[model samples]
Target: MDLDVFVAAHQAEWARLEQLLGRGRRLTGAEADELVALYQRTATHLSLVQSSTPDPMLTGRLTQLVARARATVTGTRRSGWRDAARFFTSGFPAAVYLTRRWWIPTALISTAVGVLVGWWIATHPEIQNAIGAPEDLKAMTKPGGGYETYYSSHPAASFAAQVWTNNAQAAAICLVLGGFLGLPVLYILWQNMLNLGVGIGLMSSADRLDVFLGLILPHGLLELTAVFVAAGTGLRLGWTVIDPGHRTRRVALAEQGRAALGMAIGLAAVLFLSGLIEGFVTPSGLPTWARITIGVAAEAAFLLYVYVLGGRAARAGDVGDVERADQTATLPTAA
Candidate 1:
């Protein structure tokens, strides 16, 4: 194929398309019709030139022109609060529900690790002693000690904000950093479980396991679930790198990565609720059963939301990704 001859043939049409696009206002009816025709032809031209010729500069220019023309023909869409409503009601939960296989096991294994560490420390006086002097340990585990006071140390509003920020950041990190093959996600899970184990070990050794449970159960249930969801979504994304199933690695990663990002936003809202419980309910005067009941109810509600609403959404084809039109168009590949 003669590249110069082809370029000459299309140059006028390309120039006209560019002028129409650059007009920066609504196109006349005839111009709109012309732009649509040009866009379709240019896209075909791009595919042909890509296959037959290897002119990077010309291809790049046509690629950009085709993109701009396509957008103009399709009409740009601007999202509003309705999109956010749909996301929260459908996209977010569907994403989380879809990844339940990953997060459920994550929650179970991580909890077991926490329990094992606690049991080891609680049974081994030497380890407990190594952690702190006997006197300091007693002071910390006493009736109104550090574990109990920590929740109420700050004003409630500020404390809730702080907890929300910290937990949300942790969840965001898990989702974002999971792209690196999940090593960082494992490390994060370990650190969190380690802390939980330390508290359990110390409290059980002090014969105040009930106190620790009372302090933790109110907020810990939901708070930990959000973290687990984020971690699982991230791990799922990392797994795409190793096994992308039917799709190309790039396509699989893009799909899962977008879902994980959406889950991050959803998890942030979940963490905020947990933060409220941690700040206000955990340390409040509610009886242990009452506080724990509230936490249990919240957790149950969240689970139901995922299964019922999310299942429906997924069945309806919402995969927690951007609308199809919003996604970048991929050129057809030979099978």
Candidate 2:
């Protein structure tokens, strides 16, 4: 790896590649072939210099030449509608489906927590008393009272938008902060389940648990699923920090982070649908059975989307990451 000797050998090829690149779209067939050949040789030369007896000045010059040649060899890539289509149908859903082992358990465990909290609050007069006076509880949980009326207090359209915004923010927080070893994500989940448990506990104490279910079931099914997905994904991100498996920590994080970001965008759309159900269907004049059915249908559709479409995409090697060409290049490290 004599640096001077190597530079002397390949300097002319590097210069020729640069001149061909400067010609832009005017390269003849023979010249284009020559350009491609020169580009390959220069790239190898750059790699050799970088890996052994590196010279900063020589490295910088060769790096620039290789990058220019690469761009000319492979035209620039731009994202278009096809990319968006692939994302929703393949990338986003596939990422979610792949994380099923993590999130499915998350959903089950969190649900149990909510139910246990509700049961504890319902049966314990001491806890209820600590929360508020009997009169206040009655005011809040009675039929057509605070719990039921809250959904309709605001106009339906505005309420839907507000719900969407809040849920999106919550999901985004889980995804972004999950990299903190998942502690913050866990606390956020606790707070959410606690709120739900209080509502259930108060309503059950008033002998209006059925009424509460009727109101919540119309949207809770899907809304909670999205939350669970975000939480699970965040936990996975944190776990990567602990055990990146075979990949380097930085590489694993980059891959997971990108997937989580795409998941956030996808979950926003899911939450938006649930928000619609909460704002309009939850408080509408429709029969309880009908509204709940609509909620169930929407939830079923989402599950199908994740399992069928996402499963297929994941099997085909889609990890919900941006296409390879879109990713930044990373040099290999010697162990």
Q: Model 1 residue 224 lDDT?
A: 97
Score every model by TM-score.
0.92, 0.86
lDDT of 2 by residue, 23-125 (tens): 7477889998999899878877877787786789988888888888888889887789998999999999999999999899999999999999999999999
Q: What is residue 9's positional error in candidate 1, in angstroms?
A: 6.1
lDDT string for model 1 (1-335, tens) is: 79999999999999998999999788889998999999989888898897789699999999999889877887788889999999999999999888999999999999999999999999999999999999999889998888889999999989999999999999999999998998899999999999999999999988999999989998999999999999998898888889978776777888888888889889999999999999899989999999999999999999999999999999999889988888765556445
Runs with alpha carbons beyond 4 Å of true place in candidate 2: 1-25, 28-31, 34-69, 330-335
Best-fitting candidate, scored by TM-score: 1
Error of 1 at 11 (Å): 4.5
For model 2, name the residue pairs that clash. none
Q: All models: lDDT?
A: 0.91, 0.91
